[model samples]
Target: MLLEDHQLQSIQWTELSRGISFGVDGGCLVEAVERLGLVDIVTVSIVPGGQIVLEAPLGNAAAYWHPCFDPGDSLPADWAGRERFSAVRSAPIGVLVDANGQSSFAFSFDCLTQEGEIEFGASEEAKTFVVRLAITDGLAAARSTVRLAVVAPELAHEQAVRELSVLLHDGIAGRQASEIAREPVYSSWYAYSQQISHDVIMRNASVASGIGCKSVFLDDGWQKFGDGRWYAGCGDWVPDTAKFPDLRGTVAELNAAGLQAVMWIAPFLIGEQSAAYSGLARYATHYSEHLRTWVLDPRHREVREHLVAVCTRLMRDYALDGLKIDFLNDVMNYAGTPSTGDVPDVGDAMTLVLSEIAQALESVRPGSLIEFRQPYISPAVAPFADVIRANDCPADADQNRRSTLNLRLLAISQVVHSDPIMWDPSAPVEAVSRQLLNVFFSVPQISMPLDVLPEAHRARAAELLTQWRALRDVLLGGELSVGLPNEGYPVVSSRLGSTLVVAAYQPRLLDLDLEGVSELVILNSTASSALPYTVFGDVPPVGSALAEGETAARVVEFAERGFVEVPAWGITRITLGA
Candidate 1:
């Protein structure tokens, strides 16, 4: 059912004749309405005496889904659900889907300020679902416009989410990504975490370059001595002479080994032990007990210039290919130092800092890569971010797969990457294989100590990386479809030209479209040996031609449907017999 303007206004506590100013705090002054068929576009001009809060009610919501909530989180057992949900400048959208995978109601808020809170609950008096949006900071003295949209209910949940991304992207000035941003990467985090040196990375880079990795991310521990302080040494961007005596020379060595070098930096963190902390502690906005670091206030002109200089200097001095900026979501408002800077809103200040850094880096080196991670995966940062990866799910293959898909569905135009895939050296071969196959839809990042891997594990890693390198164009750039997300997206497939690749996570009958297809590759991610498939068009019978990592092809001919008995956690390639 389409929600008309009158219906929306009627549900609100304030009565709107021309425009309502019913509250002493953040009250509306003017209202302009534009109709986009089924979707309603309502623009409100607010004069903020305090924080602004708006509530929208939906009567048909069955399940609520948002980017901040992981797909693996527990679902609602009854009418009780999460009491409060929040969105930062990083992630600012959510949707309500019915049981049939159709979006019942959706909201995308233009909270270009500090942070916004969304509360979801059942209204007992009204018997409806309520979504409340509150913008707590960054209100301008001039007219601050809030664009609230309720999307069409007819769209599939995926389509609805994609449209929301497009809506958000239309408001930002973003840049294009470089060619190398989509390549396979080898990171030094899980393998050696905080205990790396020049020799260790070069050894792994050589092995990674030989096995099809195009880039290496030098994670933490490259910049400070090993005093066991987590982030107390983060603010200073200088490399520790003890760990990497020749930073410039080490970068050259990586480039000589056919790999691009990307350095990691927490640009907003001011470690308590660093000299900058002593001078700039007054500019800090919050303190994090977990990392033992203070969040630098980006609103200050000095603070912004310092971070921009720090990032761009690395690009110029080291001739670096890119930077992996971390912990941007930690830059929100938290009542730290008073706001005494040129930029009024912290959200706008954060945006300005990232934009200036990207602009400056481009002057130093054109097509320099910048990466952001999961909860920070919004089109707002797409102007500077070339890659958006899953959050750190080190050894869990399923979490990597699910997180990448969630990011891909929302940030449709951005290049999505899996978290660095890591595993124990003595893990089973099937477990290692699942790690590679699960991240096929997105760019894969391996964080293993390749030089010291078990012989069998190293061989398998090399073989799968080689295979992924060959099919990356199809896997990353093809038309993709996902099965029921409520069921944890058990089946995902992609097609480019005539090549089709489908990954099945659960043992179920695969219903596929086979019009004008020359090749089919089934990635069995589960332990089921029999993969059952039924083709949907006028297609000829097919034969199993190649079974990877297995001795021979074992097939069973069931006249009713095609079934290939693949090894547990293996890949099978089939050719159509015309």
Candidate 2:
């Protein structure tokens, strides 16, 4: 059993105990990805002793089976009596060996790992591969790094957050950040260039003084989305020279407002149409004949140094506090160059890229925030990450709620987590809006066009945030108890310190009976419903089951443990003071 820990350095993996050496450098996998629930790293070296048993932690039982996809193998004429698992899609998983300038290797996984040949090459080491795996029952799980160092951190604050989360699980309320030293925890805004104006950023900061907008984020669009395309042209990392000429001035305004400035930086790109693509072309890995976008060759030292320099310049130029790394995943999916290139772990090249990004970013700003949006990457890579973006898009509250719940399920395994229930600037607040409200009890994020919100709604939002911050300690440091209750309705409840926050919804009283709830709050994550419940344990200060005394439920004896109902989709807070 050969095991390796990928840090910020590369350690050549040679089978010494077994006594086998392939010259000085015997091809080794450097990184891996922990996507879905399957771990994809090179446990088995290509030379020999490469087969490693893919297993989970003790006590957590799981099943494994590989199903391939075919256009027309066989299909039942009817929908009934069909296996749900029968219809699925898959790809190949193999090792890449750089022969001179070209690269290729082969590996396999079948109903059983027998008689499977894998081969892919020429691939300069630029793209990152997605070694898909189905994981079950774990929060914040990290995939194994094959035989190299350089692991990526989701954000700069991950270390502090994960450490604090562990302490929080033990009922301690302590938080650390680069700035605050230690107070008020933290929150970040998703700053979208197309939507957020200086005014919006200021207002969001002002509004957040109450709820929890610790830091303000500036998402993509500073440049252009696609051509001057999709958000991929990260190589041209300066504030889209056209968007905001005075980047320093704009960010300065946020800094003065006491809001930390965080910027969106893909930091790497290769479009022939792009300014640097022609020059970067010499170092890119050729994956497609179309040649629309080229993979960046991190294996090339110049590319690495240029990325570091560019990032440093951006930070210095904008006086920004943090950065959101968009696509380190390019490592695995990319093709590597010859000589100076290192291969990604078995099937996780993204891990290596992420790790490299973390080191480079930290060298510039030790506590830089590195937000990665994929959830599966959260666990296998959270220790190096600050904030994990649960999903790419925040469609609605219910969807967000499911996202939040699924993410929570990952939390027991992930020591660090971000609040879901997001509000993307362009996302309409129709369906899942209520779900976001309910999700506040879990990890919360408000990614909406909050600054330009109607005055009345803004005021209401402001008021709610103020209350949320008051209980920040309780929210971040409480014990979370959850229930699927047969999937009829989804409910997640957290008992933080003296307060208990619960988000519940269902059709015609979904039948939820909390066991040890001291404080009760109803969240409207679904369609509007008439809530029929009251506070169970300690009496609340302001809003309680009695506020709507007549319309809502108010059971005197069992307010503390019985079931309750809400008529609409939204969130209500109930506090319990000792």
Q: Candidate 1 lDDT, tens digit per residue, 188-225?
A: 98899888899999889888888788999998888864
How displaced is residue 552 in candidate 1, in Å?
Answer: 8.6
The ten-residue window of minimal lDDT in model 1 covers 15-24
Candidate 2, residue 260: the lDDT equals: 72
Relative to the true structure, candidate 1 reaches a TM of 0.87
Off by more than 4 A, model 2: 1-212, 224-233, 286-292, 335-353, 375-380, 411-435, 441-443, 485-489, 507-517, 524-555, 559-567, 570-578
Clashes of each: 1, 96
